[model samples]
Target: MLTNDRIVLKILKNNKRRPLSAYDILDKFLRIKRIQPATVYRSLKNLLEQNLVHRINQSNKYIVSSENSHENDVTTIVVCEKCNDYEEINVNKFKMSLAYNILDLKNFDLNDFSVEISSQCKNCKT
Candidate 1:
């Protein structure tokens, strides 16, 4: 049997660009490989520890890391309150946080970067 990380890497490789959730992984395993959710979550936690994936806080979902580490730019997430559907803002097209001028007011150290935006998506706006 392939190791957990390899299994996860294989899944990510197959998806290429699409984000896969822990539940989705569990579902896939149940359908195709018969693995348990706890196992999958453990593998995911391992991946997170290894910096191979990142947790998207807006939707509380996980996505394969685009960069290994030291990821620059803000991870914009858009959440809808009504339908509960959320999405990652098209971060490639815009300078989400690059334009901000960070000035040290009282020497407050800032680390990590992400922007949470809650609004009605196109489908929910109707």
Candidate 2:
């Protein structure tokens, strides 16, 4: 990993409780270092390719990949719509097999998949 990549990873790790946009990462560094948006983006791309980070597509933000995740683990992300809080759950192998069976029935190959479930979190509930 390059210096910038490490820096980006540190930021994500530090803020694991919430997702952050590229601008968020860039803003954090702007106060201390002279960094460009492109550099932050490049670091994010590389981290994603390496499976060191995961993107919340709905909100266009990124979070650090869980430390306990495995190669075949299916990630189910629960997003709190009201507060934007999110959590990643590792679905068990049985669920994974079910997904594979569905794909097999359709003669489709599965490389990677993400399941996003949006709902109000406990704090947001009435």
Error of 2 at 114 (Å): 1.3
List candidate 2 stretches off by more than 4 Å: 92-94, 97-101, 104-108
TM-score of each: 0.55, 0.86
In candidate 1, position 114 carries an lDDT of 60
Candidate-wise lDDT, in order: 0.63, 0.85
For each predicted model, how many residue pairs clash, with residues at least 3 apart or on different chains? 0, 0
Tens-place lDDT per residue, model 2, 1-126, is 349888899998999888999999999968757887999999999999888898888899999999888876777788899988888888765587686575565665556677788898998897
Highest TM-score, which number? 2
**Candidate 2 — worst ten consecutive residues by lDDT sum?**
102-111
Q: Whose lDDT is greatest here? A: 2
